[model samples]
Target chain A: MSSKEVFRPTCIIGLGLIGGSLLRDVAARGATVYGFNRSTSGVRAAIKEGFDVSDDLVATLQRAAADEALIVIAVPMHAVGDILDAIKEHAPNCGFTDVVSVKAEVLRLVKDRGLEAHYVGSHPMAGTADSGWNHSHTGLFKQAAWAIAFDYAVENEDPGKFWIEVFTDVTKLIQLAGAEAIPVEVANHDAAVARVSHLPHVLAEALAVVGDNGGILAQSLAASSFKDGTRVAGTSPALVRQMCETNSAALVDVLDEALILLADARDNLAADPADISYLADAGYRARTRLNARSGAHKNSVSPVKISSRPVLRLKPGAYGWVSTLKQAESLGGRIEVY
Target chain B: MSSKEVFRPTCIIGLGLIGGSLLRDVAARGATVYGFNRSTSGVRAAIKEGFDVSDDLVATLQRAAADEALIVIAVPMHAVGDILDAIKEHAPNCGFTDVVSVKAEVLRLVKDRGLEAHYVGSHPMAGTADSGWNHSHTGLFKQAAWAIAFDYAVENEDPGKFWIEVFTDVTKLIQLAGAEAIPVEVANHDAAVARVSHLPHVLAEALAVVGDNGGILAQSLAASSFKDGTRVAGTSPALVRQMCETNSAALVDVLDEALILLADARDNLAADPADISYLADAGYRARTRLNARSGAHKNSVSPVKISSRPVLRLKPGAYGWVSTLKQAESLGGRIEVY
Candidate 1:
């Protein structure tokens, strides 16, 4: 192990999908992993998945505190404060991080608790509709962007080498788990997530409610587009409620903007049907920019390689050869028949 | 073939994705399919796909007229009128249907052209992002619902046996191509598509525009939810423009409702931060209802089956037997030891 990566005996609290996934992957990557869950059933479920977990919070903390371990709090937004309180009483000096959807609020809570010196706030832009430890997989964070928000107070302060090493090790673990580490400020992270994640959830719920009013005909005729657009609305109500309550500030900002944009689109539809470019232009630009950013549409049609022997099998005519070569080019391939 | 299944020489106009898909699938199913395209390159592409396509509209019409074919107008909304005009001039007595998104407008245009006796408004709720004849596939309409709207004028009158036979044959063809034929009135079909299809497209466009306002951080943080929510936004601007313009009336209704619902959700997020069930309740119900309707969430976990086997190989200890039985049950199977 490197000098920077001395934060061992990694402990993950609340073994839901995210925490369980991290436990599996981090353990697989040679970290000494332990877990604790608030519910007995959750702890048992994690144990069934071949993970070491406990329902006892103090014992879980004491082990981490004595070992100078890194503790990842992966509970929902409402439960984060309780976990932080537990940490403050038992393991305040231990390295701590969190994976809640919101960041600014979490940082604030951590600052208020005076855990800033050993704290980092993180939110992984990843999940599936399924929840619980049973639904978690080791590859949950693979290829997803993991946002890391360092505590602003700690950032400006001259923290000792131990804290710096702990922060560096946490980043290394995230990258090792095959996620792109995107370092962002707590406020910026929350704002970005509100626009991208929380707004979509709210909009999807709204779309579903409005669609339900369209009667049986609309229900029967709903196709792939409708299905994809509202897929996130099928998430658990408790989870959705927690997210909405905790991140209401940033979510309300995006929701207000979306409502105005949607209303203007309706107005534009009536005013200038010929050029409803107000919606189309930005939509097209944003969509294309996202596609380019994600490389979603790149090289969908792969090239087919052909050898000279295959070309020789063609009929000995200029039209046949020219047409064959043109066909190959159209199919996104080249026939190198020398 | 049955007596009522006598329609032949299926003529498909504007050989884009829908028309080309129909041409390929119907031809494979033993129908003589001929195609016409407005563009030379489209005709060439169709020909490359082993379709008999022509850029000559009048000649294509004469061929259909000679064979008494069922002509399908599969063009964009703006071009529907031009094709209907050509159909009126060239093949007035033939069985006709259109695969446009907007049915009410098409029915009105067909009535205005005085071709009610030979027309049926049809919209196949199927497509991909990639358009044109080259991007077409045979299974585009597989398991999709094809909405069919009969002419109200012809419906009020006692349409002859021949018209009924034509409608039956069309439904049979749709079924044969692996799609459910949903018989709906013109107005109902338009309103339904607006709610399920057009409204989602508009909402997706609006979301992309709003997310774009969040700058680079929002773009970077945007993940699967954003991608799925805006999948249809990546559609061609020209196509989106036509759908918005032609179906603006129905779309405007849903847009207005969505705006109010979204604004209310935003308000509720602030006012009733504890529950927000006004939005979440309906969203949950609608999502679950859709999932049940589509058989999407059905059979998520399968039960294991076990056959009776000899237990002679096992040691006669109670602990071993109990442990073996428990282990079997945990693996989603039963211990069937004889």
Candidate 2:
């Protein structure tokens, strides 16, 4: 291995929102980043914007191989296999990873093709409802979670901690992009995402259908409440469908449970409308707990530990009590009045 | 009929969010708005806030009757019938109305007790997640819809249109409070609300459930996308459940329809996971439609309509053409070169 920092040359395949954003981030961090896009105009625009880009996949891959680069397949989920094939044919020695949301099938494909030695499965959970390169921003990955999958075997060998070193470096880079690296089994990741990500998409789309029967009038009267409620519904129906299909069993299970909960509430309400109070109490308690727990971790300021002793208790009418209490509290001390 | 303008001392039952807001709006507009509360502390707080309030319902009703005023019941759905019965006993001659979301059942109750001649059903489709009198704002109802229900018998007998006159006046006050008068059948109103209002509550609760399951790690990684997606889920569950219970059948219908749509999408995706393009396309289309249609209402700022006229066609190698075109477009015209 040469000491010239083999990670310097990086290739990003695709120039859509996610791909474009990653390219910009990598380039901004002093990496020589090259981009490949099927769209001639996209390639032209990226080049004009000072990126090393090419519309020709073969030419782009040849240049990447010459540089001994790492390649990131940032295409849509369905296009992942084709991109991998292209990488194998053109730049076979390059280390490869992807930023696809779904993993089980894709990881299986990589392993079966004897490409497991260089491939890692990654899912960077960051996006807006917006799409396209035009909507891309370098700050998109800020404070996001990037799940990176690493396997112990490489060509039926231990690889002697080489995979760990690569993953650690990748994790550090992800952290610099303001994302945390979470390691989990591909199946577990899919199930977890099916619950939080895919299920909401399906539910949101389903809720949006209410407007379909009511016509545009119903949708027009929809305030921020309805918009926020069905925001995920406005997500790409195709993507939502893909997510549901990819993680069908787990998504179906979650959906079934949600439906049961809703149905039970409806039945109880029919029996006695006031019984809706119980559902509301349950929801309130759940939301309050979520908010409190989330808030506890949200202090951006670094935590500091201090040891202190309470010296006195002041009565309401005690002289100099207000000033003393304020001073003590300001120093992060707990105060109680007797 | 008396020629002297009589000050109608209004009794607002249940001094909570809506009732308190109405009291503030009416009082500020020079109407004598008297509030009643079951909680003595609530009554005391209202009085402390300079409101004419009482813990005694009978006293408040008597005060309104003495001034030949209207009684506005502003309690939760379950409490409306009892409050109306109390008002009938103490202030039978005074006109009455209510500010409850669901109305058909309550309207039936009012008519069954022969109080329909004095009572009208009103549902103001406006509120915040926060409750209590302290959260009341006089401008809360501005630009919202207030549905007013009228009876044909009273208008046909006297032909004086007294109820209509009072309702029109109240509607004007509602308009002043920043709401529009939407005359609707109580059943139709409930159905419409089920689609637009009640359904959102169910969706919010569902989102809260997703957040709950995601736990601390998931919540920590939850960004603006998650926040926006679940914003409505943070609304008071009790109020939401009240809405759901009161309009259970309609909500259940909507929920069922929503689930079916979701199921269909899920199945479609399961059949073809490779077609994620459709999902992205649907999302793009929905977002585009939302953006285009958002400000098309009367209350919102009118969107700038782009003209299709190619007044001046741009020629190649035209220096400063882009800037000139931008300026021309900003001034509501197009620029092109022949």
Candidate 3:
């Protein structure tokens, strides 16, 4: 570790899929990481996978506090409150982040609980439908964009402050784990993910029910589109509920927007036979943009590599770091530090 | 070829992805097949890939007319009208079916044009975001479910008739291409695919617009769920429009249902922050059923492979063949002669 670097000794709480994968990636990179799982079976599985893990949360948190480790709460959104409380009691001074899908609720809860000092919110845009320790593996986060969120209070403060330093340390840790760390504001993270992530879960659920309503015949007729649209419906309902329920405000906003679009499509289709042109054309244009920007149209995710990553100069604005990270993301870059 | 089999000499029109792949698969299986492409470039590409293809649609139809070929119309819905007109002038006696996504509209068009004698509707539930002869491959239809639709009057007609023979030939050809052929009523096919296929296109287009509206940060944060949910948005806009516009009636029905579900989810979340359990749990159960029955949970499309397909007895229902084929599909079986 460098003399001034604060990016070592990762302490991951809730060693399920994301946490176990983090442990694997960090340990494989020869970085120090200790993980804790509430389930003894999860700990045993992590150990069997040759990862350092414990079932004792409080003790691990104390060790994390002593080592000044970067703590990652890699649990579902609903489970985060308990983990946050445990951290507050045992590892109050540790630099911490989370991999929850929703950011605003967790940020609010952290602030309300007075544990926001050493906190920088995060949500790694990774994972499969499967969960648990055994399903986790190294390289799960490779090339994935991890959203590192800042509180609104961090805008005017000097970027050299301890909190900003903690965030930079978090970004360094995220990059080390093989993910592209995109900086964002807490409010933006929640709203953006509400569209990209949370709404998908909701839509997949509705699609699943609709297909099932078509019964075995429809299931037999189901092809790539149906399969892809409902793939996320296979996720555990508990996690899905937490994702939708916790980000309820942003989710409701996107949900209303989606409903409007769907309703317009339905009404237009009813009135005119070929009026789906509006929906289809706009969607086609949007997909073309996405394909051009992200190379997501490829069979694999292949964002163009920029050899020289231009450093972001935080512009004078309300939450400049959010746009800074977004700019870097558009250029296919990640942050090591602010 | 077996003496009892009337299946041979396949004539495919439209050398796009599905048509080109069919040409590759059927020819590789040692079936006598000739493909017709309206585009000279497509024909050139197919010939370059070592397949028999011609840009002369009418002459190809004339040759197919002489050979008593099983004609397959592999074009989009709008294009099918001109092709059907050409066939009426060139090879009206040939046994024929279509691979259009929407079945009822084409069926009605065929009937209205007095070309319904040997016509059936078939949709091979396969394809990628790509198109054209160059993007085609041999194994595109491997393990896919091809929905074969029947006329309602066929329930009372003897299964040994010439039309039934033509239908059986189509199924045999589908199986030869390594796809399961499920027979369906024309009306039922439209409704079922509205839920399983068409609605997904509509939904995916809406999702693409929604995500793009979230701007670049949301795109950066997009993961597998978002990717999967909006995948069909990358399809050709004309194809998407045709699929939606041709099936407007059924699409509207399913779209309304999907809208209601989204609205309910939003209202429920607004009312009780944690009440998404209904939507999530229902979706979870539906996906569970799909996974269990189809083994769709596997990385590959695996329906439990049945070693012996039970012969479907024509039940005394309103449409026996439809139910019979659906029953066979539920057991991972395909109709060889029903």
Candidate 4:
């Protein structure tokens, strides 16, 4: 507890892989944590591991309310609404965040429940294909990027001091969990994750199906490439399905784009037999961009704390935070709370 | 030298990753191997590592012919025809095979050169995304599957005793390299690899392109799933392109199927939020099938050598090898060499 001065008590409502891991990570960082899950197995596993865990949702929220802890909903997207309702009933004034993969849907749910004022959206881009408490472990978020929500230009007071503290709390929590919290526009998060995260699951599953269709000889021949390409297909289907459904619009757009690219490659090859150049070129260019990001970040300003600049103080009402978030994102720097 | 009685002298034409690694493995297995490379650096690296390598393809082939060695053409598909022509000139009496990814195209090329009688189609399903001699290492094909082509219901001979020895030579080479040589139909190899290998490359590249399209935020947020899905996109594009082009027909078929699956998932999602169930169900079932194959293999008879059965003796001319290969492939077991 050497860092007691900046310590933020954390309460997680879902002891699945993400939730249980978050609980372990926070506790291991010398911070107080309480976790709840509907499943007896998850609670039992957490308690057996010597972590503070409970099966009663309302009791955990009540404890979080008493300690003024930041409540983190670690349930699947479909379960977010119910979790938010429970938090609102038991921990009405506690500032909250979530570890949901898709953000916009959870944002809407918070808005619907009149809990937006006390809510901060965040997603830890970590975890294995496996789920449940038994699979959870510490250091899951080590060196990973955590996307924390940023608001648009405000119409009212001095950039909303309350919201800044909420962000600070969330980022601090993320830091303790061993990740770089990157500030991002909440509305845009679903679209971005849909392309990079959601679509991959779908693609892996499709690859899996196609490999199976190759029959016996093909199955025996599947090597490292196929294994890597379909690695995510082994993930919990219900989990993947829920995430894609929550971000359906953006996932559809990106899935359509992927389908178009594949079709074009297939058609071109079918017609000319040597037209694989299309996909090969596009893919090479894309890989170059991916490589470039690593180098660009090395030369650019590191945005450990994006607000380190004078943007917050110079603002009349709303700050130019959009530009700041965009800059941090472009630089691919982690936002450090300290 | 412990098992020198079964040793097969190896001559490899091409010192790329696969070829270089094969030289290292075979030599480590106490077999005499001579490797030829177009690049001076490859030959230099192998020589520095105490491997017998040279830059003169003609001289290497001549040596192979003198020793009656098993010549291995381990270059790209587009380079195979030229290598076959060279082998026809200098090693006309030597039996040869290839480590090419596509079997049908190489089979056609060998047939065109009238070298089919002395040529065996083989593909070592190994190597990393990297290429060239520097990236090669020993035991690269350890425990990997190597596919050797079997002719379809042969006619006008007693199952071709020479071909059987050719297969035994190829399988022994694979075994010495620490791999399982799976005998498969040459014509079906292309279609099978198209689904399990070639199409995975295409899909990985497409995923990489889509991830790059997600912009800076998405790029920063790309996690293990995206990385795994797009891992093969980092491969040498020229190599991937050539492999796809060589098997364009089979690739097109499988690629089209993947597109249809993804498009159907997209359309279903667009129509109904709950429609993600289609892909989830199909993917789960496919994964189950993949898992089932492992168990099925454990229960069935193992086929280390397909000709181990009495069918070779019972056949008047054409052997019932199809059923044997099918059983081996279906069970998903590696064909061991005794």
Candidate 5:
């Protein structure tokens, strides 16, 4: 640990998949992590697995107050506001942040509560289909982007530095998993996610409706493509419902646009077979470009820093001769060969 | 080997991903395999790997005829017609089958040429994003559903029974990998694939257009949701185009239905938030069911089969524990309590 590395007693409220995962990653990085959850069994499981957890909100807040650690409200979006209110009553002096999918509304709530300076809105674009602490792992955040939203209060009061440092620490853990940090505006981030994330959920659900309508036959014949398309449909209904309600406008915009595209393609296909070919070709080109870019980005990012090492190559058609020469080279030492 | 296991010289034409994979799986079960390909390198590579491979189609066909083996056509959909014509002219005596995505058109072409009882249509609903022989593996068909489509002519001649046995042999190899065999009408199979397979490609490509219009920033922000939604887009453009073109009616019908569903959802989201929740919940339920079903299926299938030796569990937890225990129990060994 560096001398300048700031230590904050971190309180992760809700020991679910994201919360528990953050707790594990932060604790492993030498942070004092205190987890709070409603589920007694969940808390017990976390403790048994060697995590610093608690069930008492009062005591958790007191400890955070005493240590002056940041409180990360890592709960469902609907419960976040209430949790923040509870935390405010108990630990007013503590710094606050959240790990939620939708950010604009949460930021609005923080501002309305007059906790603007104390709170920084954050959303880590990382997760899996599974839920609960049992499914949480320490490496979940590695290589994922953690978006942090700031306001005038943070920048003017020099609180931005503290928030940045906290986010940097969080990003460091993410970097370990080969993820990158992307700074985006709360509205922009929400809009982006609405198009790419929430809209897919809608489409998947809509597609599922077709499958449901098709009866048992469609269900049995549902292959990998259908499975992949509807994977997001497996997410918590409550969570998805909350997201749709919270980010209704942006999702509507994206969904409307998608419908327009789909309707156009459908019309074109109905008019001419060649039109369908154009749509398919367009999709193929887009997918190819996305994959190529994804590959290039992955190659560019080194998972770990590598120390300088000597490189050696063998000439083609010289397997035996190269092996004999490499043997002699190894006897002399201080040389690397491939 | 069972006495009932039949031996026949099999010639696999166009040794690409599916062809090459089938060749390897069949050979492992003690069958004489002859491979023919346009690419000399592909033939050379197969021969080098100790398989009987030849670049000359006529020579391979003559050898297969001399041995009275079945010939399997594994090539692109558009090329199948020409290949069939060539096969009728060159290897008229040999029994024939195809592993094509669209079977109706191919079946029609075969019937038009009066090659009754000479060929059967098969579609193995399994593939990866990759193509060609280099990506081929013996386990490719394991547990995957292979659809065998027999027309009236073949069925009346009792050729369906013969083809079914050959398919059963292929299915056995796949069953070794933990796959299933499904029989359906060629038209129905094409229709089902149009919904499950072709529709996804169109949807993915449509989604990709969103990324393209928004530029690099849009694509970079595309996380797993976009990746999953667009995974089919990564498939070969030429192949997807052919699928869309060849199976136009079914693909158009599915796409039209999908578009209507999407449009309805979009309108509901814009006008009625309450209805959006219903859509979202429906999706959640469908996805949950799929995930549970897939997980259960994966749990029941064992990795490898051995006659005498006990199979060891690969991992201690939820992933591999069951298979290990089942293998051990099957070997007549009792698990000791520690």
Candidate 6:
């Protein structure tokens, strides 16, 4: 429990994209990484890829517990509880964390199983439309935000140096995996991610339905706009279902809000179609602001800069240079149009 | 009009992205191009970029009419009637077509103005989220589908050689602009593009609204998925409003259907919150099918290839190699492992 408490060999259950990625990264960091997956193919895939993995879950847990290891359940949200139960039974003394989309529910379940003090919750905001071990890469977590949900049980437990070091080591491990560790309350994390992540999945799914109904003509005419707007629709159905089901409360709420906004725009178009730029303007401004802000604060976790400096090359008497300068000023960017 | 009718200079009114890109491409094909825009700055920008552009709409139309040139109205949908009226008044004998998203209304307006024989309808399914002349490029329409709505008036007037040659010339011009000329009925064009184009815009705008509501936290967590899912949200609001407003009938219908699909998914999630893969699987299959179809027939306008061949390389004793081969076969591809 000292400040010098070393990170033990890690046990990662469920060797999907996130699990496989974590195993590859953690093992490369000089920490022994043991992996387990229920599906025989998942284990074989990892083993074939030159990793140490096993299909026997209980044995992996017992071995991990003997080393006081950090057991990470990298399964779907619904599958996390069963893994926790197995960990409690076979790896009773092991500290644990999880890489699930829904943080509040997992944290609550950990508390229900009386394992809160030994558990932390993390969610990486990094993924692709593809899933599984083959799609997983060691660099998946690089430059991504790994959200660490502040567990209530840990706050309520004895405030000792050991607990502090344990939590700090977990954060260090997350950083070692090539992501920024962001501390957030579980409720806030779920709600915020619902807006950014889950809501888009729902909308993309619905968009795909419309495209499917339109048949050949729709497919032929679908361009960059439609393709990008529904890129997530091509993802694995089980993963999409798991994410929505586990984060149902926040997701449904956000979906309802989004529908209301869309309905309002639709009704406005229905009423007076000519000047519907109000909604469009609002959307353009908001999206661009987010993009500019994202560009401005890409490396640092701090708030976005009030001003940015971007270099631009302008020819002699460049048309629209004045407007471009004005726009840069409005966005709080200094443009040196030479 | 003989079969040897040469393509005369094209006078394009509304020098935006589509118009500017067309102007650059058409002029590069050795056909003279005259551009006109209502805004003085737009004309100035085009002229500065070494194109013949003027702010005087009447002068451009008169000159084009004298050459019996084809005038392309490349403005927003709502602005089409005004331009049509101007063309009819100033360039009465000029052959005309429009590049509006909604075809039926524009065609009806052409008939209303008694210029049916002089007008054709087209909607090029190519655009970027960024609009205006600044973002326009010569290759915007390259490999894109340029849907030419078959005009009913021309069909009713006469199935003569001259009319056929005129239509052929227009199609050749569209090809010269680096796009495939797809002849479709106006009604069919409207309905199909509604599902593929307009519906995605509405959904993207709504997702952007939700992001705007979530503020900084949502913006920070917005990753590649959310970014791609809402890329269209940053497009010009005026354009989105116009497309939705002018094509309200089809857009509203598709929007309603999308909402129903989304609501069903939401209700199912709320009801069980355990398994909603039915909807997800359907969406995944549809999207993948579209992607594979897109890849298969990417070069032809014909219905997408029912099967495809994709090359793959596998190492010896690769785990799941058999399954990978099976998947390739199912997807109409052959695999070779060396």
The lDDT per prediction is: 0.74, 0.64, 0.81, 0.79, 0.67, 0.74
Would you give me the overall lDDT of model 5?
0.67
Tens digits of per-residue lDDT, candidate 6, A175-228, equal 778766555668777888888898888888888878888876667677787888
* lDDT measured at residue A146 in model 4 versus the true structure, 0 to 100: 88
Clashes of 6: 0
Best by DockQ: 3
lDDT of 2 by residue, A1-338 (tens): 24664345678888888888888887777657788998888887888888888888898888878876767788876787788888889988777777877778778778767777677677788876666677677878864666665443322334434454444445545654555556545665676676667766665555555654554434434556666656665555555555566667666666666766666666665574336665566666767775664463464354642212222344423455445434433232223334
State TM-scores per candidate: 0.85, 0.77, 0.90, 0.91, 0.82, 0.83
lDDT of 1 by residue, B181-242 (tens): 66666777777788888888888887887787887667767788888888898888889888
TM-score of 1: 0.85
Q: After superposition, how far is residue A60 of candidate 6 from its true place, in Å?
A: 2.7
Q: Cα lDDT for residue A246, model 6?
A: 81
Q: What share of the true interface contacts does each candidate keep?
A: 0.72, 0.33, 0.82, 0.78, 0.51, 0.64
DockQ, candidate 3, vs. native dimer: 0.64
True contacts kept of 2: 0.33
What digit string (tens of lDDT, one per residue) describes model 1 on residues A123-172? 78899767888888888887577776644423554455555556665666
Ten contiguous residues with the weakest lDDT in model 4 chain A: A307-316
Better of 2 and 3 by lDDT: 3
Model 4 DockQ reads 0.57
Error of 3 at B22 (Å): 1.3
C-alpha displacement of A95 in model 5, angstroms?
1.8
Q: What tens-digit string does per-residue lDDT give for candidate 4 at A1-338?
A: 23554576888999888898888888887778888899998788778879898999888999998888888899888788889889889999688899989888888888898777777789999988889989989999876788888653232234366566667788888878877787777756788899899998999899999999987678878888988888788887898888988888888899888988888888888886467887887887887777665554455587542321111111212355455555665555565543
For every candidate, what is the interface RMSD in angstroms?
10.1, 8.1, 2.2, 2.3, 10.3, 5.6
Regions more than 4 Å wrong, model 4: A1-6, A152-159, A295-323, B1-6, B152-156, B291-323
In terms of DockQ, which candidate is stronger, 3 or 4?
3
How accurate is chain B of model 4, given as a TM-score from 0 to 1?
0.88
Q: On DockQ, who's better, 2 or 5?
A: 5
